[model samples]
Target: MSKVLYIKANIKKEGESRTFKVADSFIEEYKKNNPEDEIVVLDLYKENIDFLRPEDLGGIFGPKDETSKHHPILKYAYQFADADKYIIAAPMWNLSIPAILKAYIDYISVTGITFKYTEKGPVGLLKNKKAVHIVSRGGEYNNTPYEMGDRYLRTILGFFGIQEVETIAIENVDVMGVDLEEKMEDGIKRAQLIAQKF
Candidate 1:
């Protein structure tokens, strides 16, 4: 069966941020069609993925030392490599993703694990995977060249050998004098449609 890793990076766990709700719509549709597919939800807010220590760095570069076993950095890399597909959801912060999401990427981007260096150039180690980046932006700029959230996400996933990457963005989150109900409905509708095809 296929395995999908749903990475939820919403620092706002169950509040005004609509990124999680958007991601859930996609997952709901996907689950309807592929009931047997395993869904692994990585809630970064609730997890304990610490940074690398001096001892852990030595073990990562060389043989497994006493400190490597408990390294918070290694688990994310293993989980990232194991997934056949990925669904990442994050809200736009300052025209980009939040720091928690960036930290998650940092934890998983281990050298010689997710990617490797070759004689010709660098090559990604993980293979045959697809990724969907779901971003929530506060303003509408779909056609503009300044859409940093989706672009940066696609680029980073591509660097990890995930070529089949797609994005579903919900913009205009903070438009002037707009009805909150209508905005949410529009976002949910768009998200549901993308979920059907995703």
Candidate 2:
């Protein structure tokens, strides 16, 4: 079965989050279509994601080090390395991903595990994995400089060897004078379509 890692960053709208509804619909359809696929949902709000401290960095790179002392971070890296696919659902916060999501990225970006430095450049170790990102934005900023969340994810994940990335966005959800429900419904429909092929 394909191991799918789903990372959830937010569920509430007030917190610059309006993507959960669409993400939930996508996940439901994905489960229905790919029932055998394993979906591991890591909700940042409900879980304690490890922070990449100096000591944790040492544990990852140091030879003959006590890896058990850094079990949490090591586990996170292994989980990331084992995944065949990934789904990240997060709302745009100030033109960037949520802080919790970024923290999770740090925890998983381990040297010699996710990626390794080479003579020419850094090479990603988690080969052949694909990722889909679901993002929500408050205003109309599609294809603009303000759109950084999607690009950042693609860059970082690509650096770790997952170059095949797809982004599904629910934009303009919080724009003033917009029909919130209708916009959301449209986003949900789009997400559902994406799920069918996901």
Candidate with maximal TM-score? 2
Residue ranges of candidate 1 with Cα displaced over 4 Å = 50-56, 63-70, 143-145
Q: Count clashes in each candidate, considering only residues at least 3 apart in sequence or on different chains.
A: 0, 0
lDDT of 1 by residue, 1-198 (tens): 888999987767475568887788789888987898999999888885455567766545654344544666776777788889999988888877777788778777777778877898788877778988887788886767777777788887888888988778777878888676677777677777766666
Q: Kindly list the per-residue Cα lDDT of model 2 for residues 1-198, writing each as its tens digit.
A: 899999898746433456877788889999999999999988877777756778777666665244633476677777888889998998899999988889888877777778998998899997888988998888887899988888999999999999889888887887789898888898888888888887
How much lDDT does each candidate structure score?
0.78, 0.83
Please estimate how well model 2 matches the true structure, expressed as its whole-model Cα lDDT.
Answer: 0.83
The residue pairs in collision within model 1 are none
